[model samples]
Target chain A: MQHKPIHIIIVDDHPMVIEGLKTLLSDDKRVLIKNQFMNGTDTLTYLEHNSADIVLLDVNLPDINGVEMVPKILNIRANIGVIGLSTYSEPSIINQMIKKGVKGYLLKNVTGEELVNAITQVHQGDFYFGSEVQKILADSVTQESNDQPKLTRREKHILTLIAEGKTTNNIAEELFISPLTVETHRRNLMQKLEVPNAASLIKVAVEKHLI
Target chain B: MQHKPIHIIIVDDHPMVIEGLKTLLSDDKRVLIKNQFMNGTDTLTYLEHNSADIVLLDVNLPDINGVEMVPKILNIRANIGVIGLSTYSEPSIINQMIKKGVKGYLLKNVTGEELVNAITQVHQGDFYFGSEVQKILADSVTQESNDQPKLTRREKHILTLIAEGKTTNNIAEELFISPLTVETHRRNLMQKLEVPNAASLIKVAVEKHLI
Candidate 1:
């Protein structure tokens, strides 16, 4: 008895990427290309009626953010495996996608064999991460253990303004918040980031890519 | 009459990258894979005895820095085109490579066709930068035109220290420069960044990725 070929869908904004991936995976007999979509909306629309064994999803999409669309895709068909693909190796984005139920993460430069293996593994309920991705994830874990603070959206907004040397009044006015509230947020940021004052806070924040 | 096929060399540390690129370009009749190397030393050694029309050089190498190796490679064969390939799209790194005489820059995620086009274009003495790379270059130019101050190495060092909330004395001791000299550098940084005070200076520097 022969097993059915794994059907895979490619979703990326770059036509070149779709073409390249298709060409790379064409030689693999175990995999079959179902369709390619240039954005998240088209992929979602197609997936509403159709399904694939795996989805090669680009992290940055034109219409919908790929991470944001992961859950939606799973909602459509929870059994479909997703493997994040992108040029970026940012731990934050990778972790976000993993948290949202992606089965694997691969960089855009992935080898054809690696790509096929990741798709196959994810389809079989195994997790896969490119070597570079694994390194980034490892580094992020270490950084987190070292007390890297996770800032909320509002906190991050205020931090950007603060890094721009905006005064409390300036930030409060720009963000439409009370000066007292801004101060409280500022205090929280400093404490969370483990900085003594504004200067060190900005320095650490920039170093950590918080702004 | 038949023209010579464009001989190309691949110099990337990853075995997968070398194999993937070779596989992708195998079908292209216009190009021939002359050699492959895992590091800069082997590539330089191979180039010293032989020559190729193009070298798909990785920016980061285990033995020698790819950017630093560009001029050396050209020195070996001045007509040979060097294209910097990497996952990074940092404006500073790209500009440095371009300034050092690379004919093109490509992201590692480049499609087989784009890869072929880049090699061919560079071999023909034209320049090529991937779309993402082009955007970065354009953004850098715009930032420069917007009165963005270009800081020297010493100035940037001082600015980082300032952002970290270090005083003149601390910076002076750390850098082995006199307090007066550190103060001068600090003043110069503020003026160049077009900010009136230390806080604003740090803010702008962080915002611009100067730190």
Candidate 2:
């Protein structure tokens, strides 16, 4: 019996990582490395006209943020599966990538077998989060959920967008509001939560189950 | 003439990771897996009775913290090389592990070639940090060296201990101070840095090049 190899596009900022991924998948005939890109811009450009079964997208790219890149890739190719990759696994980043529509998430240290398994599962229209990634996400859920203060509906929406890795301009543009208004909402959220920055705000939100 | 293979022990809570590592290195004749342990205690006990050329230890273990495991391993066998492993790459953890005498550090996603190279390099008494780990450490160094207030030498020492993933009790014991004094120092450090937790304190300290 013959099976079509799952086509994969590897996107990472580091040349060695791309090379390593290629080497890891070289012997596996089940998944084919159809193309590779060093940054997000080239990957987006490639996906505009071409398509692949799965995209191994790095979370940190020189050009575009990996979380934001998910939607852009999906906007162009609705059916394509994006599997997030990164050296460090921040629960917020992984959770944000998933909320934004990644079919799978993997740490950069993924074994070849796990890589193939993730690609195969994602290509079959299922989710595949690597074991470590699963543990991180699970840990996030088990954190002591605290009783929290309430926010206005608009503020909550903005907080979600913020947690989703949106820039002020991106959120404003998406919500059809002014950037200044978005900034004000952000400030209010911080003040209400008593956090210093967006990262901490998201951390608090995750802890409070507010977002 | 054939050289003797390096004896290696695998320590990770994940059984799959150990199996995958074995499979990855199965074809390579230069190294040998002498034994494997799913927790740090057994690995430590094994080290007491027997020593291997290298120990591939996971950063997270069910029984012990990975970063703290370094000094303990070296205490038992000063000549044996210890290579730190983790699913995600945390710069502080990597830096702390290096400070405590880990010859090499690798993310779990290491390929057979890189893993073997790291082991062989460390076995030869050289340092080997995976490319991604190297990038992360580099980023940590390049963080803005902030112009900040000065800390007393004692405060700085406690800060270093904290960044090395030490607990209040551990710091107190090591520094010959009461745990309450350690708590006071930690609180003062947090107040000076205007951060709420040890993690954030470390982040600011890293950014300021204070640690």
Candidate 3:
């Protein structure tokens, strides 16, 4: 059956990565390289005037975070598929990206065939994941089903600020809350995460993707 | 003239990355893939029994940090070349890897040619850096020559604790110092980093690689 070539856009900050992807996927006859961008801003700008069937988006970009960019990209083109690509297999990041509605997740080391398959799958409205990504997803699912702590929106906000090294006073000033309230939230976060100290609290929060 | 092929080991947690690297470098006649491992412990264990000319070490690993693993790997084989490979171009990580005696640093997106060239250069006892890594190094140097804060060891420890969201009391308890002493050090760190709040202090310190 004859079909239109799937248009794909590559967005990553590293020139070498972009070049490598181009070289790796050039031989695939079923896909057309629509464009390449180095940052989220440029990707968004290109998407405003153009359309693609799939986007291979790096999880970390020089401008905007790839996960944060997913929903924004979707808002611009509701049907375009987004694939999260990164070197990290952190369950937290992978889970977050999936939650943000990426159609697939791939590691940077995916084979040319795997890349093609991922794009093809996503183009056909199926989700794909690299082997390691799949493992992370499976593990995260198991963990979430077990004892994942549910955090309030305010607590999540405070936790992120804390991860950024905000003091209680600074968080209070920024959130327009009392320092005591921030401290209470901090303690509540620690208790909920079951961490003994601030360092362990931050570490656990990061591991659990609470922040 | 035919020369002996360089033996190389790949250490990264991602099975696909290892597979991809094996596939990418398989055709290079001048280099031989001696071994591949998924974590630092296995890499170290392999090094304990065997040796390689170069180790393409990922900065982030599942078991131990790649940077921390560098000296341990070198300890096993002092003459072996260590090349830091990662998705990050963060100056702090790059600078730390280089300082720890890695002969090269390459981003995960490096072209096959660049990867081979980096291995060859490192094998020949020369330092090589990906273009983006070079730019980060250059910018960090410029920034350091300007107003980069000089922090003492104790202060650096305190800064790390603070970034972990530790309060003065928490830090004092952990470090066995008085709360007033911890507060003084915290104030000094903020002053030295020229940040108005703890958040900005950590942000600047991280940007400057002070911690």
Best by lDDT: 1
True-structure Cα RMSD, model 1: 4.3
Each prediction's DockQ against the real complex: 0.27, 0.07, 0.16
Q: For residues A96-186, what per-residue lDDT tens digits would candidate 1 score against the true structure? A: 8888999999986688889888988998899999898999899989867433478999999888887776899988899888999999999
Runs of candidate 3 with Cα error greater than 4 angstroms are: A1-55, A61-80, A89-101, A106-211, B145-179, B191-197, B208-211
Q: Tell me the lDDT of model 2 at B122.
A: 95
lDDT of 2 by residue, B1-211 (tens): 8999999999876544666677777789999999999888998998999989999988888789887899999999999999999866777778878888999998765777899999999999999999999988888789832336578898999987776657889889998989999999989998988776665676566555576
Model 1, B193: alpha-carbon shift in Å? 4.5
Candidate 2: regions farther than 4 A off: A1-3, A10-50, A61-63, A85-91, A106-121, A126-189, A192-211, B12-29, B33-39, B45-50, B61-63, B85-95, B105-118, B126-187, B190-211
User: lDDT, candidate 2, residue A108?
Assistant: 65
lDDT of 2 by residue, A1-211 (tens): 8799989999875544666677778889998999999788899899988999999998888789998999999999999999998866677778789889999999866787898899999999999999999998888779722336689999999987775556889899999999999999999998888766665566566555576
Please give me the DockQ of candidate 1 compared with the native complex. Answer: 0.27
DockQ of 2: 0.07
Regions more than 4 Å wrong, model 1 = A12-28, A86-89, A107-117, A130-139, A142-154, A169-184, A203-209, B12-28, B60-63, B86-89, B106-118, B129-139, B145-185, B192-211
Whose DockQ is greatest here? 1
CAPRI accuracy category, model 2 = incorrect
Candidate 3 local lDDT, B94-153, one digit each (tens)? 877877889999987777789999999989989899897898889989876434567899
lDDT of candidate model 3 versus the reference: 0.83
lDDT of each: 0.84, 0.83, 0.83
Q: For model 3, what share of native contacts is present?
A: 0.16
